[model samples]
Target: MGKITGFMEYERLEEGYRPVEERVKHYKEFVVGLTDEQAKIQGARCMDCGTPFCNNGCPINNIIPDFNDLVYRQDWESAIAVLHSTNNFPEFTGRICPAPCEAACTLNVNDDPVGIKSIEHAIIDKAWAEGWVRPQPARIKTGKRVAIVGSGPAGLAAAQQLARAGHDVTVFEKNNRIGGLLRYGIPDFKMEKWLIDRRVEQMQAEGVTFRTGVMVGALPSEGPAAKVTNDAKETVSPEQLLAEFDAVLLAGGAEQSRDLPVPGRELDGIHFAMEFLPQQNKVNAGDKIKKQIRADGKHVIVIGGGDTGSDCVGTSNRHGAASVTQFEVMPMPPAQENKALTWPYWPIKLRTSSSHEEGCQREFAISTKAFIGHKGKVTGLKTVQVEFKDGKLVEIPGTEKEWKADLVLLAMGFTNPVPTVLEAFGVEKDARGNAKATTDFIGGYATNVPKVFAAGDMRRGQSLVVWAIREGRQAARAVDEFLMGFSDLPR
Candidate 1:
């Protein structure tokens, strides 16, 4: 520990946010990262606790104490090195991750947790500014080729690791861009796209090949999968990849968004959050979309209380929606969690995102029963108040009501990967429809099909980007071992 008593002397400092009025006018990151001195102070707050729970709390198991100590010592270079040791993209997680590590911080038991996330943001930004980030090309070539499907965080992480391990890695993306969900699913206001571009450039320099607009295997042209944004110009059969590459890794995301089967769902102006989100992302990237989903002067109703729904609220507000309201079927969590009961673990508590601060009416314990419309267009929706009784979600009598809404965005989260993609490769699926695979040490990430592996959302369902990176790194080792009978790569 750099300063043993620093935790008791220093107060926690959070990163600042741009004013709501100023930031809502455009789609760009609004967070103001900590200055060097502030970051140093935050790092000093990392106490000499016997065990660092923050490590396990972090999906990638970053060496938090070491980085915190390095930062406290003003070793910016070492801080970034420790950060990059586990996380391939701190810029992505530092910006968008929910910071579960902070929740598990020892200081959080009684006082504010160390501003670990802000410190991480500052470290990475400094690293990039100082040109500390560079491609590390392997000195020796393994001669083994690997094909990874989907260019999201998982696939990108695996590709980078495989390339660094001297294996020829090629990533296939169905979208026209290299970053699958990161390019389209996320809003630019949260993280700019240039970050992904620079990483792609670095990966290319490291001998990783990116094939964009190429769909490996096949996806359904209709139904839930079709709702996901895809701009494939070519289709590569599963057999071709299996034959051409020594190993195949399925790292695509869970693209099948959960749907509401209520009446009037087919009415105009109703769309999945994916359908509405990607269009704005494409538009932000300078692509002109036809009949883009606009919320200007319309009452927008966003269903599901999660990050995706919050993003919809922000985007709708940016489009000058007359009013934006978010709905959650589950009851609202407590404003704060009881630390004594939930220490060293993620806790359930009410979270107010920057989007909520901009403008939004939040509704909890409400479920949409049916859509109300006129002349084939949505006008409103019918909802009922619900409560959990005897472990059942039962609707309360006489609690039915109608709410005005010109547009409805369903953001209830994704169920699993598009079934067609897995089926096309003759891959078996778990009960949840994700690619069936295990995380065992002997043959982790390997699917039921020979020479085929799965990771990230495609194998584990919807999760955080950090988890995707972890799975990708581990799966890469598994694949490497399968190829060379052993792997020197870190787990």
Candidate 2:
């Protein structure tokens, strides 16, 4: 909290973006973060609401108010310290997270919430620019080895935490590079890969080893799971990891894409969003891709209207598609939320992303019926208007329609971690097909197999990146406690 009257004086300031026309021409980050003075103004708007719901709303429980106050006081160094205390990687969350913390801001009941995410972005960027983000290498080594399966946020967080605790940590990634979904699945225009690179360098100096192109367990050789990006040149069995490391944490993400198995599913030019997104990312990194997917001059239909779908729209636009259309099965939400009915909680309301502003047709309450194709290639698709009745979606009669398309990208979310990876460790899966692990303090993140643990999307289903970081940090404490009688790591 800063000035008591600041909330009434300052309107929330939004971070700016490069113009749509110019931004679409390149795969560089377009966000123009706030200046120091602007950040201080935003930070001053944080009112001491007695109880900060924003903290609890944040998945990692970042000390939002403290950082806000520090930023207001121009204590940039201390601000980063407070931010880093809870979140291992503020840069990632600051850019891509949906910022549910803002939704829970007390002022959000009547006005715009404090620009918490923008402040965070400013703090971290300033810290890096000032060379304040240095490696915290442990003075003494624990002599214990920890193996983390995955190089995503969860694995990265755990590896960094465990390394700081003096444990010898190794993170295995099946991809050719680090930063799992952050490296591949996310569009480069939203967040450049360099941010991840610098963090990886810091972790390396802290004694965390990263082994890319190495698979922890066998991936499925066929089907949807197989489509998940894998550049593994070397394979290590679960038993090998168990024998070599004192503790093994499976932090692999849910990689199995939810498929649309209607008629003509096998037609060419139909691809999963993951398939299309990653290739562009790889190409941006200067990697040569054979037969890379492109949307130039093609009418594209993107199914699923979540963040992934929005990303598809943006990327398709960047590819200079003739047209872009997105479909969401659920009915459109109201333009504004009834704050009294749903406040201090994430509400269901209409959300238009920056990508939507870039240009695209968004269709709500629509369901794809089948793909239309000729000569073994997808040319268009058929759809029907649907409405929920008795908790079931029913297609309306005479609402059927067909649309032409050259490419159809399925942006439906992921269902679960690849079954083969879980099966390899003999890990039990919950009803949702995620690793069975309770978050109870005693043995949270521990798998059924002795000394084996799981977290992130591998344990929970598809979720935000901040949640993954939280699970990873908590799991680090649990593993440290298991290794020693007690752990100094924060919960």
Candidate 3:
């Protein structure tokens, strides 16, 4: 390993952020990346641990120590190579992934973890700047056609792999953009849309075709209630897709958001996080929204304490909301986790996102009982303090309270993938309603329906972008093997 004693001499260095005052005014990436020298120093902090648990901690099993060592030795080209070998998009994961790898870092048991994520961000950004990143088209054509639904991380990953394996790959997206959630669901403040566009260009150069605004199920005449884009368009039918392509892959995301079925849910001001989030993204993309969900001069109440909720808070702040309050049903987690008990595994701890740092009123162990509204519009929320007793959530007496709220966003996570699409393919679903496809080597990602495969959130329910990438790549290998009777692609 380069710089064997570097860990003893150098301390971990973190990436900086733009000032809250300046950053809150606009929605753009604010993370200040490390300079070359600083990145090398951070990379040197990686211990020469014989067993790299960080590898297992990463969803895509990135060779962290190898890349760290390469960066330490000033081997920029090799570092990016090692990075791209495992991860299709380090830029995405480096920005948004929770970095479980750092949590499993041996140094994190006491001292700060190696700045692995930041180092990765630096390497990839450098690689792009130096023209080291380029499209690698397949050397030969396999002449087999493949159809992939949804253009999110999973579908994109799978398409890239299959295209590189010499198969004809076409990705179908319901939205007018190539990126599924990445284009519309995620805010630009987290990751710029240009990054996704660059990747799409690379994918197209690699021989993958992207068909946007083409739904794979029954075509809608007026679009669904939750139209991704304001420019309404007709949808495509499942039968048309099946008849056109030799093989089909269901990689659509879990779009059916979990709803709060409490009273007054039908209030006009109450909306799902998806309903609000995509509008902001569309506006950021320079679209003229008819009625944007503005938090301006309004007391915003974001229900459910998760990434989506945090996103709402940040967007609301950007919208100049009068106030933002986030509610969590479960009790607040400890500020720090007991490392001794949860080492090498993801631990439950209080995570303060950049949005939280900006400004937010966080309430824990609070449950919303009813949405107080008037004339079909929400005006306030009635909530109660909750306690866990005998494995059940119990409401505390005399803890009922109502808070003024002009707008309510339900940021609770997704329950399952939309069943209509899966039903169109006649794919079997698991108990959780996810597509029932095993990752075993024998059958790979094949579901009950022959010639059809599933991966990512469509198969595993809601998960991180990194996990989706891993699943997509693996599923591509499965498909390639099934189609060619043997696959040379990496697993």
Give the candidate number with the greatest lDDT.
2
Candidate 2 structure, TM-score to reference: 0.99
Question: lDDT tens digits, residues 1-491, model 1?
Answer: 55799999999998999999999999999999999988999899999988899999999998988999999999999999999999999999999999999998888989999888998899999999999999999999999999999999999999999999999999999988888888788999999999999999999999999998898877787877888888889999999999899999999998899999999999999999999999999999898899999999999999999999999999999999999999999999999999999998999999999999999999999999999999999999999999999999999999999999999999999999989889999999999999999999999999989999999999999998989999999999999999999999878
What's every prediction's RMSD, in angstroms? Answer: 0.7, 0.7, 1.8
TM-score of each: 0.99, 0.99, 0.97
Model 1 lDDT on a 0 to 1 scale: 0.94
- Model 1 segments more than 4 A misplaced: none
Question: lDDT scores for all predictions?
Answer: 0.94, 0.94, 0.89
Q: Name the lDDT value of residue 34 in candidate 3.
A: 96
Residue pairs with backbone atoms closer than 3 Å in model 3 (clashes): none
The local lDDT score (0 to 100) that residue 78 gets in candidate 2 is: 99
Write one digit per residue (lDDT tens) for candidate 2, span 1-491: 97788999999999999999999898899999999999999999999899999999999999999999999999999999999999999999999999999999998989999999999999999999999999999998989999999999999999999999999999999999999987888999888999999999999999999999998778888888989889999999999999999999999888899999999999999999999999999999999999999999999999999999999999999999999999999999999999999989999999999899999999999999999999999999999999999999999999999999999999999999899989999999999999999999999999899999999999998998999999999999999999987899999
Better candidate by lDDT, 2 or 3: 2
Question: Whole-model lDDT for model 2 versus the true structure?
Answer: 0.94
Off by over 4 Å in 3: 219-232
RMSD of 1: 0.7
In model 3, the number of clashes is 0
lDDT of 3 at 476: 93
